[model samples]
Target: MPRQKNAFAHKKNTNENNQNKNSYQKKPEVIQEQPEPFEDLIPRIERLEAKFDEFDSSILEVRKRMEQYAKEREEEKRQEELERVEAEKAEKAAEEAAEEARIAAEKAAEKEANKESQKENEGSKENQAPEKNSKDSNKNKNSNNSAKPFNNSNKNNKNKKRYK
Candidate 1:
């Protein structure tokens, strides 16, 4: 029985080895080692480097354009500030001019009012003088008329006959 067991174990080991050999042997790995010549690879490497250089140059160009755009934007803001300052100056000048005009108009109106007042004073004086003179003349004439009867009595008294 021991010999038979030994023979069965030997047969199992031989079968596993055979399966491993058969499975591993059918497809052999092929190693292809073709050494590329240095001259042929140089142009390919140079083309790849040129492509990388072109990409880098494009990135640099974009950066330059962005910087220029930023500068232009800053300049535009400065121009806007200048314009605002100019507008403020113009507005102030206009306001001052308008104020001066208003003052001139007011002064002219005041002068006219003073002239009118002076004229009114002169006219009132001229009108009042005649009224006062006429009143004085009327009083004198009434006094003269009342005294005429007294004057005639005095004159006729010399012609009367005296009764003792």
Candidate 2:
């Protein structure tokens, strides 16, 4: 009987130890924190919003600068193109002036040549006039001499007939 009583007490002590081990193995409860109040988060949100606005302004400024640079480049190109066109026009004008000068020079040369030829022809005509006058004088003298000799012969024939 005492042995039975000691066995029962041992069994009760073992059951208590098993319960303690099981309790140690159980998962602990998770502690969840409450969300921050909206009022408390307002300042932080404002700060973030301010940072975004600053970033956007800087971006806009950079964009404006880029647009200004592009416009300046376009203006420079336009000015250069206009200058090139003006240069071409000036060159063409110069060429035209030169061509006109050349033509005028050629015309003057032709006029001078014509004047020289006309002078030469007049000179030749003057030289031929004296030769023609001299030839005509010689012909007149020969005809007069021949006519006088014929007249004398006829006179002699008439005198002989009268004497006969």
**TM-score for every candidate vs. truth?**
0.50, 0.49
lDDT of 2 at 140: 90
Candidate 2 regions with alpha-carbon error over 4 angstroms? 1-49, 128-164
The stretch of ten residues in a row with the least summed lDDT in candidate 1 is 155-164
Q: Per-residue CA lDDT of candidate 1, range 1-164, in tens? A: 45454556657778779988899668777988867768778989999999999999999999999999999999999999999999999999999999999999999999999999999989998887555558778889798886654466654676563421
After the best TM-score superposition of candidate 1, give how far the Cα of residue 35 lies from its true spot, in angstroms: 3.7
Tens digits of per-residue lDDT, candidate 2, 1-164, equal: 45454546656778789989899788898988867769788999999999999999999999999999999999999999999999999999999999999999999999999999999989998887555557778899788887554458788999999999
Number of the top candidate by lDDT? Answer: 2
Candidate 2 residue-wise lDDT at 63: 99
Q: Lowest-lDDT window of 10 residues in candidate 2?
A: 1-10
